[model samples]
Target: MVERIDAPAVGAPDPELKNSPIFDESDWDELSLDLELESGVCYFNDRSYAIGEFVCSGDELLRCEERGVWIREGACHD
Candidate 1:
């Protein structure tokens, strides 16, 4: 006999995907323009970068991930 696994209820957020970053929507006020997710590019500081690209802001190194999301890789070194 085969068994089936139950999935979480709809609209319920996955706990694994709930990690909070220091930078969030509240920080958008410092930006000149809003970020719009492009087809295959990530938008940061009003600039568009291709996927898997890296961006350096101040001392932070950010990487462009899928879905136009920018994930912090680590600190930027000179």
Candidate 2:
């Protein structure tokens, strides 16, 4: 037999907590570090790349991921 524990449902706000704005406009401005990031693009060395795009850094080849991050795909060849 499994024991069950009572708990609040997911996404349900707590009654004891006060509801207020988590962040102001100024805070949002500070958090907006990169404009390209808002467009679902990756930035490398001052260049913006689309998702699934590949780039070469020296000899290493990198692929742009969905989260605006570059991942190593392989080595660049001539």
Instruction: Please list the C-alpha lDDT of all candidates, in the order they appear.
Output: 0.49, 0.48
Query: Which segments of candidate 1 are over 4 A away from where they belong?
Result: 1-38
Model 1 agreement with the true structure over 1-78: per-residue lDDT tens digits = 433222211222235542212243344345334454334776554455677776565566666665566565555553
TM-score, each model?
Answer: 0.48, 0.48
lDDT of 2 by residue, 1-78 (tens): 443322212232235542211222244445445534334676654456677676655655665655465555555554
Candidate with the greatest lDDT versus the true structure: 1
Instruction: Count clashing residue pairs per candidate.
Output: 0, 0
Model 2: residue 43 alpha-carbon error in angstroms: 0.5
Error of 1 at 6 (Å): 46
| Pairs with backbone N, CA or C atoms under 3 Å apart (clashes), candidate 1 | none
